[model samples]
Target chain A: MTDIATRATRVVAATGGRRRLNGGGPRAGTIAAFLIPFFLPFVLFYLVPIGYALWQSFLVVRRTGGQYGTSYTTFGGFEQYVQVFQNNEFWSSIGRIGLFGIVQVPVMLFVALIMALLLDTPLLKIKSFFRITAFMPYAVPGVIAAIMWSFLYSPQLSPLIDLLNGIGLHPDFLGPGAVLWSAANVSTWLWTGYNMLIMFSALQAIPQELYEAAKLDGASNWAIAWKIKVPIIAPSIILTTVFSIIGTLQLYAEPAVLRQISSNISSTFTPNMLAYAVASGNNYQQAAAISVVIALITFVLSFGFMRLTSKRAGL
Target chain B: MSNQTLIRESRVSRTVVMALMFVLAIYFLLPIYFLIVAATKPQGDLASTNGLAFSHFQLFKNLGTLFSQSNGIFLQWALNSVIYAVLGAVVGTLLSALCGYALAKFTFRGREFLFSVILGGVLVPTTALALPLFLLFSATGIVNTYLAVFLPSIVSPFGVYLARIFAAAAVPEEILESARLDGAGEFRTFFSVAIKLMAPSLVTIFLFQFVAIWNNFFLPMVMLQKESLFPITLGLYEWNGQTSRVPLLQESVITGSLVSIVPVIIVFILLQRFWRTGLAAGSLK
Candidate 1:
């Protein structure tokens, strides 16, 4: 009877061991079921592609050996990178856009700041109407806005030209010298309201009590705007500046669309345009290298500007 | 300080303000006015008539011409755009919201690291990644597919970052704990409790993704070679190029351009409540 009881206890212990083996498992395996829906497509479409781009940028496509069809060649070691660096049109487009940044960033920000201040005025009536009107352009997509401006800038379509022609002056808007400013104007028109809205939202957040106190202290509108509101929204201003700078650096859609209507804009009109041109010309390696370089410069410039400006503001 | 004097001054200033507002409104609405005007005019009228004037308003005829031209390819591009934007925004916003909720509520290993990486990614421009992304997809033999464009757009670092910030503010930890204590599963809690709480932020993220995807031109241009797959922006540009030769295309292009802003305008009006408030909150943050 004792031997039989001991055998029964051992059998029960073995059953318990089997249950433990199957009951609990790693969370990673279990959680993976929930995760697959979210992570798989992202990794497949985003992470893998970005990884391949980096690898392909370093690779050289070579037609190989002495054989007619079999001569696949080697890495050629930074040769593509060197070629991109030496491409005169690519360099010129980068330079031109750099000049554009020098013009665009300050003008847009300054105008946005001024508009926000005006809208913030205590005497301003019908505030919602002005605010909506100012920000309405932001609703128009950039390409559409560009197209609309192109029409307004066109000699055939511009009412401004008709007005000028009535005054006996057929001023050239799409001319080589004027076209850059013309492009910049389109950008400003599209973006000023956007930047203003950003700044205006920040301006609205400044406590009304502070303004009431300033009024009691006999502070002029300009003084309150310059000393109080501007200083307070300095970070927001810098934020907009950084965004504008990066956006200008990556200018493509506007320029690309403009190229069709205006003959002056060549295939390599902007760095992005230049990179695209190279890719179209079957120089993918060089295009990839140029893109990487442009990306690096844009990152450095944006971050660097933020750091420098914030330091100046003593933030 | 007399009531009569104050009334007189107020009326005068109101008149001045109205005049100023009128001028500003004109400057802002002129493009739309011109597009509408141009869309109404026939090809000959577009060249001869004043850009701002309406000449017989050929609305129905232009619509007919626009659709009938090129086997209704404009409609095809419009459909393609809607597919990309709607699908990308919906999928992207969901993932972003889910990831954001987890980071906000869950205490796990490498949470901060994951967050910081996302923040860093917010600074990296989409254009910067485009070339690398293209190469990677092509290597995997997925280039020129809608999946190529749509997939990359879904992984918006900014959207995720915004979602995290919003989730932290909108969904309190105490609520989550109570749901857990009630024996609600994590998934159930997130979908039922957390999602309801995060509705406003989710809407904001969705609108941003929609507008962004709709406006996106470069990615589609790079990833798609087929004209059938082109978004309205690229499609219009192609049509515009042909307009210099095929003058009839000018009417279609103009009308299509006007019609394109309709969905966005409707989106703005319907979603303005969420957007305006979100914008205010976001800027303050």
Candidate 2:
């Protein structure tokens, strides 16, 4: 089991020591042949586009003074970035997502952790049924999930609204104040199971003897779960949290779909949506700046979380 | 007496946990259940009837309308999704396997640097790239074409990352050496020996890419303007947007959404072990 675990780690880590060869292994030509199929498209699609976006972000769009004016991109140092900083809609979208992430990520991860713990325990029967049910939403695309939830959120079509009204409590899921949480619910619904499975798999990796000793000490399942199990699975929890944070920042599809049904959701409901809206309006330079800023924020948040968690774990 | 009390206390806790688990399961399944129930109802019943209960069985009729509407564009969208997902997964998996195998088995200069770059690609949000890709594709006059989505979908750094890990874990050094001694060419040895050992991991990679492409909405939304070129997600979204104008399309949209997700859900449930293996390998990293 330890051997398998070690191999799994090496496989996942992808940082195993380089194999030494007496004659320097395969020829460089052969290696290039193996890699070029991927790297060609990777450069064309991923790398070049990034460079293009960065370059575009620095260029300001100049429109000739007339109807049907010719527009050209000219280098304007930090102009677009300044414009993005000044754009209240961009900041509002960012702030909206910040609020969404601050609340939704922890709530989703907490629920996922509890679900993982429940599945890991002996108290749950029909484990596979429960597991599949939770994980099923991961298979559903964001657009469809949002569509489904939109129907349920509709006061006109929703029995949920009717049921709430029957109890003399009015509920408005698509109201301006409530729409962000409604979008957050779609995300939570989609990802909680996937996160649970991640944490559950980590739980399964723990040695059974770790539990045996605790049980013999008269540790209740609750004590064992919260104390022994939770600490052991902290890395998995952190991993899920980081992924959730990234997903939260890229919130587009759910709100975009919901926007079709609700006038309450603005075109710039999220940063990505804001970027798209800007680009669609022929403001490519500003859109590029927004994209670059969003990417930088994503990089900082994800890496910062990883670094902080590893530091905490090391201590 | 205390031992008996302890047992009774544990039983109570177990009951509480079981009840919690049951409630969660229902919560998880409820939206999907609502989707299924909604899809079966006729257009008028959708607004009038209970959301959880069936009105009239119109799933077949609704599906017919979905396929036959807009010159059967729903079928086209479904086909586009499959083509994009399957072709993308197949080619992407092959490219990833070759690159990953090289990274794992060969001794080469700057290999780790290239691997790190690819890892960086994994962190770069694809959503951020959509607008830039749109501009590039538009410049090349392929903005609304299938290649706009296909070319980008096939480039999966995450797939390469997974393939590299699998190659390192599954392929052994002695076998490659023996194959080399047997006078097999590098490509021949890989195709004959390494691939067989790495087949399971390749499926995992394929499924991951498949789902990613299938679930993709942003790139297509930005790139494709033609309704026929839309994937099911984008197609259903377009239809859903029109439901206010033509309320009858609501049933079609609901039915279409259900139809689009069924195949993916089946694939996921049937091949769950692979997913578990993939997630376990992924999280442990």
Tens digits of per-residue lDDT, candidate 1, B1-285, equal 688986787667657656765676677878888888888888789878888778877888999998888899989989988999999999989988877776665533445676776666666667767776776667788788888778887877667767777888999878877887888877888899999999988998898788889888888888888888888988888888897889778888899999898778767766666666556655553
- Model 1, stretches more than 4 Å misplaced? A1-50, A62-73, B1-24, B281-285
Candidate 2 CAPRI-style tier: medium
Error of 2 at A81 (Å): 0.3
- For candidate 1, the lDDT comes to 0.78
Span of 10 residues, lowest total lDDT, candidate 2 chain B: B276-285
Alpha carbon lDDT of each predicted model = 0.78, 0.90
> lDDT tens string, model 2, A1-315?
998985565464344344422153666578788999999999999989899999999999788977689987799999999999999999999999999999999999999999899899888788999899999999999999999999999988898888899899998999999999999999999999999999999999999999898899988888999999998888888879878887888889999999998999999989999999999899898999999999999999999999998898883
Candidate 2 has a TM-score of 0.95
Judged by lDDT against the true structure, how good is candidate 2? 0.90
Interface DockQ of candidate 2: 0.61
